[model samples]
Target: MSTTLSSRKRKRGLSDAKQSDSLSIELSSLSDTQTGPVLASFPYLTLPKNTPFNVSVRGEEEGKEFVRCSSTIAGETDAIEFSGSANDGSDGAGSRYFLALHRPGSSKLILQPTPVYLISRQVKALKNFKPTEPSSSEHFQARSMLGKVFGTKKAKAAIDAQERNKIDVSAMEDVVGVLQDRIDEGTENLPTQEKLQDSANAARLIPAYNADAERPEDIYPLHNIIPEPEWAALDSLLSKLKNAADDRSRVRLLPNARSDWLRQHLMLAYSSPKPKRKIAKMLIYASVMFAFRGVAGRNVPERSALLERLSPAPEVVVDGLLARFTETPRGSTKARMTSENETNLLTHLFSLCLKVDDYATDTALIASDLKMSPTRVNDLFKSLGVTRLFNVVMTDQLMFVEIASGCTIGKLSSQDLKRLGLPDSVGQEKRAILKAPLTFPKPRLRRRA
Candidate 1:
């Protein structure tokens, strides 16, 4: 009985193990069947092959709760159609489904519902539009109609003239205000008398203004200070100088005989028992003035006949007078003057004299000719060095003589001599030239300490 009971207990243990195995298999099979139906039931949508369309979802915030669909097929009429809800769920009847789009470039997928409306549009044909051409008869008719309305040509011209002259009184005050401002600006820095004189002298130096006046008496200052004979001789000499082609031609033109005649006359005037300082001074002034004026005047072939008459070359005398003004080159231990340097010195001297004349010149006219500003011309004057005296402008050397006792050329102060680029002995030498016959001095090398 004990053996049988043990056998029955073993059988019962085997049966219990078998039943547990069957229960585990049945549970796994049931789980697989439930997962398969859930996966199959997942919502999906398919589009027609090769159909090109753009789908976009409208958010609630935008006052829209639908998806928009747009598509275009060539040669087809554009149409829009709306599709209702895609799915029905237990939670909500007529539930909407969303398709997650994985755009190629986007990092995250966008969840959007299938587009409700499918839209397509067709391109309209272009139309050819052109302006209408007016017929000749139409133009004739228009002109005739206008002629009838406006009356005769004289009447039309009168109407046009009246229209042109019609003034706006309302804008006159504003125009006046603008003009007043311009006038103030123009007159604010009006040039002084000295400045005006300087500008005039500069204008005279320019050929354009010089050509306008033929006689030296009309343009030159202190022209009548000397006697008529001396003045005539000097004017004749200047005309020859103006007609000469070059420095060589000038030298050849004024023979030594003519030069000696002038020299003898000047010496006689100065060495007279009663030497008139005015006559001597006038001779020197007129000679120097004519020399420079000749240099500035335009060359004319018509004046060649006047040049044939014997006249002194004042340029030679003027050269010696101006020799003291040449500057020594910078960084040079010794002063070495060249022909080019002499030419430059003479040019500067001529310019200086012209810039410091005693007559007022129109600065505007000069500035316009030079295509520069009056201020720029003034700057050029300052660079050349000028002195203002009363209502006249003159060179430093002239000013020094003018302010000196007896209004005679005298020794300049050391400061002034240096400022004018002259040697210490230049003043004494210049004063001595006035006492004797004017002659060209020998060229010599200058030494700078």
Candidate 2:
């Protein structure tokens, strides 16, 4: 045999040798009709290995023999695989072995290798439970939230549609100060960007509530799909990934498939018709990535290195948020999520997007998902964009990226672009030329970290 097998055999032999005794009893002899022994008196116990040996009975009570067990040598051979129960021995438990010994009484002894256990019973089945997800209403009423986030567009347009009074070319410092204060001292531990949006939400709530704003439970009933227990796991994962390393790390979201609850949806979406499923799964992934990159990772983007590693690549088709650029991956379809119905249907994917890839969900897809036309979907994306809905929901994210890296952020800055210490005279000169000031007035700056 092979070396590994030989070693295993050696170990098993030693183990069995230590357990099996030198005596045993063969009960099958009791019914040996050929002998014509009248059988009603005894159990027909046959001591195969030489019997007449001392047997030990271990038990709770000192009086009764809870388990009367004996062992003896039979022959060198392996025991049975399964050991539930049999008519010959006690309810079989632990490993058992038999050793035959002619020196003892009849054949009535056994060893631990083939020894039986006293307790054995069949196992029962587990109970069934309902499936569910988390409730966003606990922090705010879903309807109100939908209205505030989804509703702001008209309010913004109506106010800005007409010529509205422009704020000072500056109080930018005061605006920055209040924002810093909110970031440093306030904000709830919400799974979504709603936490970062206290100021904007309050602006909408004041006129609506007028009185005290209600608590989470009082706002929405638990009937909504998000309010269920199943959503809690997703919420927890999103929260953990958000604070993972830094805000910048938010740019790239590669969630571990084993840990994510949404991976099942991706798998499920691709289970039916192969072609369609592949497309849908890819769209779902893209949609989620869009959310994570633009909507989720805005604040606390400090960990530069980690964020760089996590950031989506230049090739990621993040057309969902911006609705401008997209390229279908090899094994995917040109699908998009465009409606609120699509939003709900795509929630699982959206949750995943909070940290994965860039996607391109548009109004047309939303409309089709809702059994409506692309008009509403287009209108919806537009309004949603202006509201800055969801602290995460960014208007310029994909727009800027939808423009793709055709124009990098570094292009807008004036910081020196250094190359090798000794080289780069020509490139440095070109960079110096681009740094020359154009006439757009710079805005007031916030204090640096």
What lDDT would each prediction earn against the true structure? 0.37, 0.31
Clashing pairs in 1: 200-361
lDDT against true structure, model 2 = 0.31
Off by over 4 Å in 2: 1-199, 202-229, 232-357, 383-449
lDDT of 1: 0.37
Off by over 4 Å in 1: 1-155, 182-194, 202-320, 323-449
Cα-based lDDT at residue 356, candidate 1: 29
Best by lDDT: 1
The C-alpha TM-scores of every prediction are 0.21, 0.16
Instruction: Report the C-alpha lDDT of model 1 over 1-449, residue by residue, as the tens digit.
Output: 01111122335445554322111111112221121111012124333455433322222323232222121112222232223221112222343444544556534444444322222332234223456888986875576567658779886676566557878778788689888999999998998776886675553222212223334223223331223444444555555544556444544444332233234335555344565544444444434433433332232112222233213434333333233322346884433444444333333332323322211122333334334565654433322222223332345344212210111223455764565456666545322001111122333333322
- Ten-residue stretch with the least lDDT total in model 2: 401-410
* Local lDDT at 316 for model 2: 31
